[model samples]
Every structure is written in C-alpha cells, then in structure tokens.
Target chain A: AQTVTQSQPEMSVQEAETVTLSCTYDTSENNYYLFWYKQPPSRQMILVIRQEAYKQQNATENRFSVNFQKAAKSFSLKISDSQLGDTAMYFCAFMTHTGANSKLTFGKGITLSVRP
Target chain B: EPEVTQTPSHQVTQMGQEVILRCVPISNHLYFYWYRQILGQKVEFLVSFYNNEISEKSEIFDDQFSVERPDGSNFTLKIRSTKLEDSAMYFCASRGTSGGETQYFGPGTRLLVL
Candidate 1:
C-alpha cells in the first residue's frame, strides 16, 4: 500500500506572494507518478500538476509547479504569485506506473488560504 | 476541452437505501475511477473500471459497493445499502490512454447518508 503524508494541515499566503506545500510518500516502487490536486469550496478535485518519476526535470504549470525529489520521496507544490482564487484544499497523490488500474492514493490535504 | 461530468452534484439518502452515483467520462477516455472523501479526510480510492469491468478495487470497496460502465457512456457506483459512515464526497475520474498519465475529474457528488 502507498501512503502520502502532508504534514501541514493549513497554510496562509498573502495575495501575490508564493507558498510551498510539502508532501512526502512511502513507496517501494521505483516507477510511478506524483500529482497535486486542488479542491476548492465547490468540491471539485482539479488537477494542478504532475511529475513522472523518470523525468529528472521539475514539472511546472503556469503559476503552479512541483519540486519532485525522487530519492527523498518528496513531492511538494509551489504556487507562485498566489491569487485569492488559488485558495483551496490541496492534495498530494501517488499512482502506480505499472498498471491500467491507476488509482490515486491521496494525502489528507492542506487548506491554503490566500489572504487578500 | 472535453471534461468528465457527474450528475446529482449532491444527494441526501436515508440509511439502508441504495444510492447510485453517475458519471459521464470524457468521450474517449478508457479508464474510470471512484473515490471518496469524508468531511476533512483524504481522498481514498474505491474502484477502477476498464473494458466494461472492474480492473482494481480497494478494501473499502466491499460487497456493498459496486461499479458498472453500463450503456457504454455512463459509469456508475452503486452502494447497495448506505450507512451513516457512507456520507462523503464521491469523485469520478477518467484517464485517457493517449495522455501522459493525468486523470481528469468531475465536480463530485456529495452523498449524505442520514
């Protein structure tokens, strides 16, 4: 079984500032995928970014990016130029690369509040 | 861009009643999944379906829980008998075979079992 841990339960960032949410995982598999999903008050789980274990380069998406340390089993999400719209519950998830089952094991999530 | 969609964004059901959450995956997606999140809990996988059958399931997906991709376009998760503990937000996700491993998600259905 895979376990994802987001040590911080809540974080606050001033608008236009940056925030990094930390996440760590325990897995024996070498090949897999890491993801950050954002769930706003609307309850929709939106994919923010993803990182493939094989890719040495970090994954970035506009204002969202990931610092994926494969050896440390750490995948943290960084939101640059944070906006009030970015305030949401963020989840760190893991998926196996071997199969089509592709179920995401998610962390408890961190509530991010972007102060206006 | 095409997106996965789920119906009855919220549901309120009595304990012991059966509830079926519906999802319409992206038209060309090949894999579907069901997940649950209770209040402030983490999202947990329930089951994964492909080729019209279940490909994988978690321990939480016991006998009371079942999934079906009936009629080719709709994927549904049926809870035979609901318990108070079953109240949670259920999310439906779909993955395309061509994509680089990102699963698209629906808005989710909040099931309140009272």
Candidate 2:
C-alpha cells in the first residue's frame, strides 16, 4: 500500500512571503502521480498543482509549485507571494499508474495560515 | 471551465437513517469518485466508479456504503445506515482520463449525523 505523510501539522506565513509545506510518501511503484490539494474554511477541496513522477522538470502553476524528488520519495508544495486567500489545509496525494482504479492516497494534511 | 457540483450543501439526519449525496461531474468526464474528510483529518478515498460499475473502493467503504451513476450525469453515494462516525464532509470528484489524470472535486456536502 502507498502512504503519504505530512509531518507539519500547522504553518504560518506573512502575506507576500513564501511558504513551503513538506510531504513524503512510501511506495514501491516506480511510476505514479503526485498532487497538492487545498481545502479552505469553506471545506471545499481544490486542486492546487500536480506532478507526474516521471517528469523531473517539476510543476508550477502561478504561485504554487512542487519540489518532487522521486528517488527520495519526497514531494513538497511551495506557495509564493502568499496571500490571505492562500490560508487553507494543504494535502499531498499519490496515485499509482497501475489500473483504472486509481484512488488517491492522501497525507494527513498541513494547515497553512497566511496572515495579511 | 466545467466542474463537478454536489447537491444538498449540508444535511442533518438521525442515526440509522439512510442518506444519499448527489453529484454532477464534468459533462465529458468518464470516471467518478467519492471522498470524505472528518473534522481536521485527511481526505479519505471512499470509492471510484467507471463504466457504471465500481472500479475501486477503500477499506472505509463497507457494505453500508454504495455508489451509483443512475443517469448520464448524476453520481450518487448512499449510506444505508448513517452513524455518528459518518458525520463528515463528503466530496464528489471526477477525472477526464484514466492514466493518472487530475481529478476535479466539488465543493462538498457536509453530512451531520446526530
């Protein structure tokens, strides 16, 4: 089974600053996908970014990017120019490349606070 | 951009009662999924559906839980007997492709079992 872990329970960042949330996973599969999801106070889970395990270039979307070190089994999310709206619970997820049953394995999550 | 939408933003039901959460995934998406998050916990995968059948399910998805895509666009999750432990926000999601594609999620339906 694949497992994702987010060691940081809570993180705080001043507006306009940058914050990085740490995440790691344990899996035997060589090919997979990694994702970052944000759940705001509204309780809506939204996709932030994604990275294909085979792609070493990393994925960036506006202020969000990931540092995916496949060999180390680490995938971290970095939020640049953080704003108050960025405050939310960030989760790391993993999806195997095996079959159509691609269920996501998510980390416990890290609560981020972007104070303005 | 098309997105998944879930109905009944919030539901309050008595224990042992049956509850159904509905979702309308992206029009062209072929795969549907259900996920839940208890208060201050991780988002747990419940079940995934494709071709009108269950493709995958997690341990949390017991016999009491079932999913159905009754029509062309609506995907539903039914909890036969709601329990206090079932009090959580349920989210419906869908992906356009099959090989590790990104799944778009709905705003979620909060289920309160009392």
Candidate 3:
C-alpha cells in the first residue's frame, strides 16, 4: 500500500510572503503522479498543482509550484505571494501510473494560515 | 472549465437510516471516484468506478457502501445503514482517460448522523 505523509500539521505565513508545505511518500512504483489540493473553510477541495514522476521538471501553476524529488519520494508544494485566500488545509496525494484503476492516497494534511 | 458538483451540501440522518450522496462529475471524464474525510482526518478513497463498474475499492468500502453510475452524468454513493462514524465530508471526483490525469473534485457533502 502507498502512503503519503505531511509532517507539518500547521503552517503560517505572512500575506505576500511565500510558504512551502512538505510531503513524502512510500512507494515501490517508479512511475506515478503527485498532487496538491487545497480545502478552504468552505470545505471545497480544489486542485492546486500536479507533477508526473516521469518528468523531472517541476509543475507550476500561477502561484503554486512543486518540488518533486522522485528518487527521494518527496514532493513539496510552494505557494508564492501568499494571500489570505490561500489559507486552507493542504493535502498531498499520490497516484500510481500502472493501472487505470489507480486511486489517490492522501496525506493527513497541513493547515496553512496566510496571515495579514 | 468543467467541475464536479455534489448534491445536498449537507445531510442529517438517523444512525440506522440509509443515505445516498449524489455527484455530477465533469462531462468529459470517464473515471470517477468517491472519497471521504472524517472530521480532522485525511481524505480516504472509498471506491473508483469506470465503464459503469467498480474498478477499485478500499477496505473501508465494505458491504455497507456501494457506488453506482446510474447515468452518464450522475455518480452516487449509498450507505445501507449509516453509523456515527459515517458522519463526515464525502467528495466526488473524476479524471480524464489520459493516464495519471489530474482529478477534479466536488465541493463535498457533509453528512451528519445523529
């Protein structure tokens, strides 16, 4: 079974500053995918970014990016120019590439607070 | 962009009652999934469906839990006998056919068992 771990339970960042959420996983598969999801106070889980294990280049959205170290089984999310709206519970997820029936294994999550 | 939508934003049900959660995944997606997050816990996968059948399910998805894609646009999760432990946020998600595609999630339905 694959497992994702988010060591940080809670994180805070001043508005306009940057913050990084740590994530690690245990998997024997070499090809897989990693994702970062944000759940705001409204309880809506939204996709923030994704990274394919086969690709060494990290994935970046407008304000979100990931540092994916495939060999180390580490995938971290970085939020740049953080805003109050960025405050949310962030989850790290892992999906294997082998099967069409792959399911996401998620981390416990990290609560982020972008303080003003 | 298309998004997944879930019905009955919140539901309150008796401990032994049956509850059905509905979801409408993105129109073009082929694979669907149901996940649950107990209060203050990580989201856990319940089941994954494709081609109108269950493709994968976790141990938590026991006989009490079932999933169906009754139609093209709707995917549903039914719990035969609800328990207090079932009171949590349930989210529906879908992904395109492309391998390892990113999944889009619904806002989630909060279930309360009293």
Candidate 4:
C-alpha cells in the first residue's frame, strides 16, 4: 500500500510572500504520479498542479510549482507571490503510473492561510 | 471546459437507511472514482469503476457499499445501510485518457448520517 504524508498541519504566508508545503510518500512502485489539490471555503476540490515520477523537471503553473525529489520520495508545493485567495486546505495525492484502476491516495492535508 | 458533476450537494439521513449518491463523469472519460473525506481528515479512496464494472476498491469500501454505472453518463454509489461514521463529503472523479492522466473532480456531495 502507498501512503502520502503532509508533515505540516498548518501554514501561513504574507501576501506577496512565498510559502512551501511539504509532502512525502511511501511507495514501492517506481513509476507513479503526484498531485496537489486545493479546497477552499466553497468545499470544491480543485486541481492545483501535478508531477510525474519519470520526469526530473518539476511542474510549474504560474504562481504554483513543485519540487519533486523522486529519490527522497518528496514532493513539495511552492506558492510564489502568494495572495489572500491562496488560503485553503492543500492536499498531496499519489497514484500509480498504470492507467487502470487509478485511485488517488491523499495526505492529511495542510491548511494554508495568506495574511494581508 | 468539461467537468465531473455530482447531485445532492448535501444529504441528511438516518442510520440504517439507504442513500444513493449520483455522479456524471466527463463524457469521454473511461475511468471513474469515488472518494470520501471525513471532517478534518484525509481524503480516502473508496472505489474505482471502469468498463461498467468496479476495477478496484479499498478496505473502507465494504459490502455495505457498491458502485454502479447505470448509464453512459451516470455513475452512482449506493450505501446499503448508513452509519454515523458514514457522514462525510463524497467526491467523484474521472480520467479522460489512459496512462497517467489527471483526474477531474466534482464539487462533492456532503452526506450526513444521523
């Protein structure tokens, strides 16, 4: 079985500042996918970013990026130039590379608050 | 942009009662999944359905739980007997392609078993 761990239960960053949320996973499978999801007050789960294990290049989507260290089993999300809108609960999830029966294993999640 | 949708944004039911949660996955998606998040807890996988049958399920998805794709567009999760612990937010997701594609999630249906 695979497990995702978000060590930080809560995080805070000032507007225009940067914040990094840490995530680690335990998996024996060599190829897999990693994802970051955001849930705001609306209770909607939104996809923030994604990273593939085979690719060494980290994934970047505008203000959001991830530092994926495959060897260390670490995939951390970085929110640059954070804004108040970035406040939400962030989850780190893992899925096997196989397309069939792809079920996400999610972490406990970290609550991020951006202060003005 | 295409997206997954779930009905009954919130539901309140008594214990031992049956409840059916509905979902309409992306039109062309081949794989569908159901997950749950207990208040302040992690999102846990319940089951995954593909090709009209369940492809995988977790320990939490016991005999009391079942999934069905009754039609081309609708996928449903049925709980035979609701329990107090069953109160949680249920999310539906679908993948459009094979390989490691991203799974688009629905807004989620919050089920409260009394």
* DockQ of predictions, in order shown: 0.80, 0.74, 0.73, 0.80
Candidate 4 lDDT, A1-116, residue by residue in tens: 89999999999999999999999999999989999999998878999999999999999999999999999999999999999999999999999955668889999999999999
Models ranked on DockQ: 1, 4, 2, 3
List clash counts for every candidate, in order. Answer: 0, 0, 0, 0
Docking class of 2: medium
Better of 1 and 3 by DockQ: 1
**TM-score, one value per model:** 0.97, 0.97, 0.97, 0.97
Worst 10 residues of 1 chain A by lDDT: A96-105
Q: Which stretches of candidate 1 lie over 4 Å from their true place?
A: none
Which regions of candidate 2 deviate over 4 angstroms? B98-100
Candidate 2, residues B1-114, lDDT tens digits: the string is 898999999999999999999999999988889999998889999999999999989899999999998899899999999999999999999988645389899999999999
- Candidate number of the best DockQ: 1
In model 1, the Cα lDDT at residue B34 comes to: 94
- The pairs that clash in candidate 4 are none
Which runs of model 3 end up more than 4 angstroms from their true locations?
none
Write model 2 residue lDDT over A1-116, tens digit each, in one string: 99999999999999999999999999999889999999899988889999998898999999999999998999999999999999999999999853569888899999999998
Q: What local distance difference test score does each model get?
A: 0.92, 0.92, 0.92, 0.94
lDDT, residue B74, candidate 1:
94
DockQ of 2: 0.74
lDDT of 3 at A7: 94
Error of 2 at B17 (Å): 0.7
Error of 1 at B68 (Å): 1.0
